[model samples]
Target chain A: MIEWSHWLPILAMLPLVGGALTPLLFRHRPAAACFWAVSVASVTSVVAIALLLRLVDSGGFSYAVGGWLPQYGIELRMDEVGAFAVPASLLVLLSLVFSRHYVARAVDASRVSFYYALVLINLGGLNGFLVTGDLFNLFVFMEIFSVSAYALVATAREPIASLAALKYLLLGAASSLLVLFSVGVVFAMTGTLNLEDAAAALALSSPMPAGLALAGLATGFAVKAALFPVHFWLPDAHAAAPAPVSAVLSALVVKAGIVGVLRTLELFGGAESLLQPLLHLVVWLGALGALGGALMALVQRDIKLMLAYSTVANIGYIFIGLGLATASAVSGAMVHAVNHAVIKSALFLAAGAMIHRTGLRNIDDLRGLGRRMPVTAFGMAFTLIALSGAPPMAGFTGKWQIALGALQAGHPSLVAVLVIAGIVVLAFGIRVINALYFRPPARVAVASATEAPASMWLPVLMLTIASLALGLAGTPMLEFVGPAAQSIYGTLP
Target chain B: MNRRRAGRILTAVLIAALAVPLMYGMVQLPAPGHADAPAHTNVSAGYIERGAELGGSENLVTGVLLNFRALDTFGEVLVIFTAWLAVAAVAGTASNAERDPVPPSPVVDYVIRLLGPFIAIFALFVIVNGHVLPGGGFQGGVLLGAMLILLSLVMDAETVARAVSARSWIWLRATGVLVFAMVAVMGLPLAGYLFGLPDEPGLRQVLTVALELGIGIGGGAVLAGLFFAIAGADRS
Candidate 1:
């Protein structure tokens, strides 16, 4: 019998190793590279799903790297939080499948293999980040994904891509430095890099440095999560990248920031004095982000830019749920993270397909695409409504739960905020739907455009179905992540 | 102009406000080198005590880096490799037509050539002696990279490129991640966990040295690749 715990490390390693070999083995053959990358991601997805199943059956487990106990060496664990690898790997796999035909035009020929390699490496980093129990390892995995994401943004052929990537790189580097510095501070205080051990130590430590570390980590992760006031870099970077890269960025990458924040909350669970103020502040910031991001998204002419802003809006909703610190609210936030990832990636890929076919990105220009490309347009339209938190769709479960939790927590104003944001989101969704199905073709590109290939539409279609299915599955998901929220927050109201 | 100046002033004010708490936090941390500081007593003490016997290196740093926290080192190595991969993907290899028109002076060229062999040997020494020495794969690899960069400065990049085929160069660049991964997996059967150094002393030593050499060569190649990508030596 296999010691299934061993699979945890391999979950991260397989992709990293496979990615490292992609360019070496398929440098000259991009089609082969796509096949190779998809194969590796598929295998990784299998491993991730298997591990998640084991976690469900057996509860959470840990694997100490090199046989050294957690205190002396790194530990990789699979809790409900780490079970995020399942969706993350699945999303990357779909994105890779979508990339087969997309990259042929979106990226330069010689760099195709490198594009696939970087995406795989980014998944590897994200998976590693989700599983690792060591603080420094968290920082390392963050860099691996971050560096790849920066480069992935630049892989687009647009002239603005380089500047956007540079902006992202600079801000990302600053955030990473903050995280590393905080890690240093924690290490100095606790002398142990293990998250559990350090958390125990921090519970009893002096407040000043502990508060600083908490502040640094919260701010750093907030920036990465694109919380309001620090989300300036996201719109440009996400909007400018190739569509599949954008999907990955807006979907899995930013959620890693949320995961980071969750880990921070777990680390400081015992330090309630420091957490309360931060939580209170983030709630208002989240409200601002929810409103501001929705309004910005509504006004965008470019379809991709609108989607990018919507990501910020959704991130805002998740943060609000997190900040409320109620059981339902936190679980709602966690479930919403997964739902938003599914819905947003579906939206991005469908948008990418339209853009790929017509080379048009403006909402007005993509008018009448409904007739020209039925499947892609419908997927986009369905997911768009789902994205608006409409009932019986993926977005509704989390928003409703969050609103319930807000009222439960005596923050009725936040429920109003959630409703207003939802309505604004629905307004944009209607506008886009009207353009696609009602408005006549206004541009030559729209009139001439055809549906994208099966590779592209298949993934979009799958995620579109998933967005609805996940909504129906919401109760179970909330139940699943219930323990995780409880464990991370340590007795939430 | 007044508004811009006011904005600058506001920025400075905010930064200063931020720095006050940061500095205060720094001051409250246990002072450096304090005998009882957690940095000295907790995990570090364990590493100091048993690192040589359990971690399989006389140099505690190497023991920790290679045996105790080997996964982080592997990640660091992958990070470097990914850095080169990213640069190559973004900027692309420079076309041969874009090569520098200026040629190097004979004196500088001769001096670089003279120093190259010794630098290479010293890098090998540092890497191989990492079990007992301060300098290991990363440091030695950096030296090797510097030598390559120096050579490229004086010699034709085409000549340097031709020394190894493009395919082989890529494999060499991937050596660190690949070899580290291989050793890590080997530990599953031999030492009962991923990234574990084998309990057999002789075999463990061999695997550690192999990891150092792989990382050394791989890091050196990736650094040189980054330089080439920036300098436009990549024809592909």
Candidate 2:
């Protein structure tokens, strides 16, 4: 009978600690390594669901280790925000687990353990980043996650992987530097590195420096979240990474940055009037990322690269909701984050499995996949429908909320951009779906062109189920996200 | 296998095995209290303080890093992490291991032979004394990493790898984060904050020292591992 609070930390650590120990224990046993890794991840998923239940019943709880107090020691402050990320992270982590067999077969045998370790660390980093209350701790966790990501992307040893890793490394380093400088500036001015304390300090201080600090933070987070002008590293990096990594990267890592920016805004926005201008800029940038990324995706021949660009486009929708900054809009963004994580992770893993089966990554080369690999083809189709914001899907509910928020905000221009972007998204989505499912088989089916093994398809199935479940049964979720959105925008007055 | 060589290697391994844990375990011991005695606020206020201060600087650590003791931390640790990355990237692209041309300089070699052990000891002292003194673990750990790097450059990559394996170094790096997270998470319950080390002077100092040891191990290992990664790239 483990206490509920203990479950929260354990859920984050099980993957991480398991990752660190995997190589030592199973360096010689790939099957055993996969079994253990999946077990850890599955347990984490169950724990996350359990933790969410505790949150619903108890509201927010803070757990301190070594009997230390919040002001003086480190803590895990689990609030509505922390609760919100649990299901999403669990869904993604489980997908990574489900994709293990596909990855083991597709990737080098010697690197299998290392790959699982990186996945576990990525999960731990994401969960820790979401849950931690301290600013510096968040940065530390961000580095762990980013470092693991850099290596995971380059692990394939493809030329493109190296180039993408280098590109991501440079941008990631720049983002870290910007964040460090901003943290330093904020600490110097406020004499506190805690988010809530810093928020109060900013409210009391003059606007000029505080505004500058906010700009530094926003720009840094924007680069991580890969919003329009700062999103150049995303396509190459995502396209080059191994499939499960791509799913986690696009679905989860980028959202962590969005969470960071949202947290910053929540703590500091109330007292500052300059935030409105910032919100305006985000709206425009979101519009551009959506339109530009979708247009770019339309021309790509590589399926992975095309999906990567679509990620940039999907990210734009999130920013648009965030920019709207209304209760419903913010809730929509939160919901979208969870929805995208599930759908995108499922799609990428399915794409990876397809590639694994066929030994091809290009759209043209993927002909007849639907006939040969029905499960993957069908899964990808379901994901595409969700990605396209089709009805009766997770993506639709999020977009619906964004559209409603835009209407409430009286921003017709933003609404027009959203509508146009939606069309572009639908266009590219159909282009890929057509190439995947409708295109005739150019080559006879090989024995390899079957549905992925149960391990790989299981998580994909889970994510697909989540996407549909969230879409169909969102009343509870909508209610759950409401208090969180209120915390961000303070219940609209 | 050569008997004498095996015996020497055995001896070296034994020494390392014993020494490494001793080094870490020592940092876990109780630490001294924060200095309570008043000192001159400005450098010009005292003779000893004057020489330690930068001409225009007010903050001591910033002054030490940017001015007087700058080469050790800023120049050595931070710059070296950058240099390792640079070498790794360039050498990785060249598809060859980059080699240094000159042999070890006798003068510098002799100096390190005499002073290396003492210098490492002094660096540890500074790290442990950070609360009362100006220097902290980051600077000290960099110095330690620099020492390993120097040995690697003067001796060989194999020697350095033998001294501390890359696998263990990576573990050390992770351990640093785990330790920090543990300490911070520990603070969540009673302290109402993360990493809020108790104000009881003795306990606080002890905690700080433990934290420093973790940092030192982590920073040192990262520096060593980065070098190994870059240097080992030649094999690929």
Candidate 3:
């Protein structure tokens, strides 16, 4: 049997090829674009899973493009962290699968094929971003996805959609520039762009430039990850987007920032003093983010806006795990990244299905949708619990580890913030749940609304079940990430 | 200010507070580009020592881009291509119905008509000579793209449309990525690396030129496609 992952380059390239061929394949057959895009994403996801499995079994491997030596070339290195491509690709796959019917109603008919094309390109960009080990290449892939995301956000037919995308473009572009500036700093300091070499080299150098580089990298990724205080653009951008677009943005795209932060942490493994203060900064920022995001989320009337703010809070959770900077904490961050990608996408897709059916955006208008749309309502409920960190779900697994790690790292205070954020999340979850199940229907349209098509509801159900499965079988997942986490934290250079 | 505005002001203040540590960190960095800097030591020394021999290009930048660090260039190529996709999606007005281009001022049209051929030749030269010279895929691609827009400016849309119809234009626009991907696949069978060019000098030359031509042609067409899309001249 062929070693499937040896074709990793092709696996990432496959989507770009599909994206390039989409307009050709579906020029007149616009309806087939969705199917084509879905097929491409599925293949990419399969390969990503295969690669992750390989990494889990044999540890990860590196591929040098053009066969150049590490000192002179770009390296695509996949470890436990890089296995993020699996969830990222799978989430993109689900979103596109959900978009088949959703896109017909949500977007202009003429641009349907183009929409799928953008999705494929975005998928390609994301996979490439996760796998590449070179810093500048990472920035390059960041732009690829960011540019596609900006357009996708504006793909919806509204003035505000374009306006929101423009604001996103401005802010996102600024983040990208900051990332590039840091890349330049590293390149100037180390004469190399490869992450491992740059890190090893910087370990021997003065701390001043290294600190500057770290600061730049952190600030840039903070914006991308939507950390507290810098999260102003997220609500408008996420809410205004077409739902599938928002799902992926909320789910996988922001994870890119966390991935970047982790990579930088790993790269500068020997710089303990630098990482110490950075982690301290991260812990406090994450605390504020969690508290602030939940507080803001509680007041939102629009369901999607509430979900977006909740994402900010969850990002805060992940950053807390990361900022604790213990092996367990980093592991928790990784697990949460995976869990949130699944839960949040499921929630967004469910929300999208409901919105598609009844066209209600506000939580109040969606009252009693549980009776009308049983499957989506239940899916949303499971996702809400997952989001709020309830026990016996993926959410609790990550939160438990992170809280334990916070104590391990001697930060008892973050655990308090964790509790507070979780409670607030519970309050909002109850609000949405009450609207879905407990309350009487205020709108006749919502009262009579039927379930979305199988194509739509099936993905929501599948993702929800996947999250539950991940939680129940959470031990094995943690075991798999165990080596990867230990490798990152244990052998810090 | 009202409550919302006050809250916004508070958040802005907090954001600034967070950025202060970062500014302090920047201030602490050594000034960039000193010969004694950490970056000038490790991998930089090695690349400078043998990049040409290893990468088989006379020009070090081209060698690094085409052979050593080709993946980054590939990602950059994809980034620009994605940007074109985004631009087309947002503002693309190109319909299938080809419309006549309004005539431009004689001076402008005549100048472009006269210089377009030379510019095209120069772009080809830049791409072809990239292995031995400064300009490679991106520079040549940009030059060629600029030339295409210039040609379109002087000649009517209908004239260009007839030469490369909307249907054929799709393939043309994808030529860069397709050719790049194809060559990448071919590398697997040829040199046992996905983006590897052959180690043989002649083969390296051939592969580098082929990549240059592919990127140049593809990038130029995509740029022109963006122009048409934004100008609303594209039709399915």
Best by TM-score: 1
The DockQ score of candidate 3 comes to 0.59
Instruction: Please report how far candidate 3 places residue B107 from its true position, in Å.
Output: 1.8
CA deviation > 4 Å runs, candidate 1? B1-11, B93-97, B101-105
Model 2 in CAPRI terms: which quality? incorrect
Report the Cα lDDT for candidate 3. Answer: 0.83
Off by over 4 Å in 2: A1-14, A27-29, A105-110, A443-448, A491-493, B1-102, B106-110, B113-115, B123-137, B164-211, B233-236
Local lDDT at A74 for model 1: 97
Tens digit of per-residue lDDT, candidate 2, span B45-99:
2323642332113334533332222212211222223233233322343434466
Error of 1 at A467 (Å): 0.3
Per-residue lDDT for B9-99 in model 3, tens only? 9999998996786576666555556666556666666667887888888888888787777777777777777777777677854354555
Angstrom error at residue B3, model 3 = 18
Question: What are the chain A TM-scores of the candidates, in order?
Answer: 0.99, 0.95, 0.97
Candidate 3 lDDT, A300-344, residue by residue in tens? 999999999999999999999888877787788889889988999
- Give the candidate order by descending lDDT: 1, 3, 2
Poorest lDDT segment (10 consecutive residues) of candidate 1 chain A: A484-493
lDDT of 1: 0.94
TM-score of each: 0.98, 0.81, 0.93
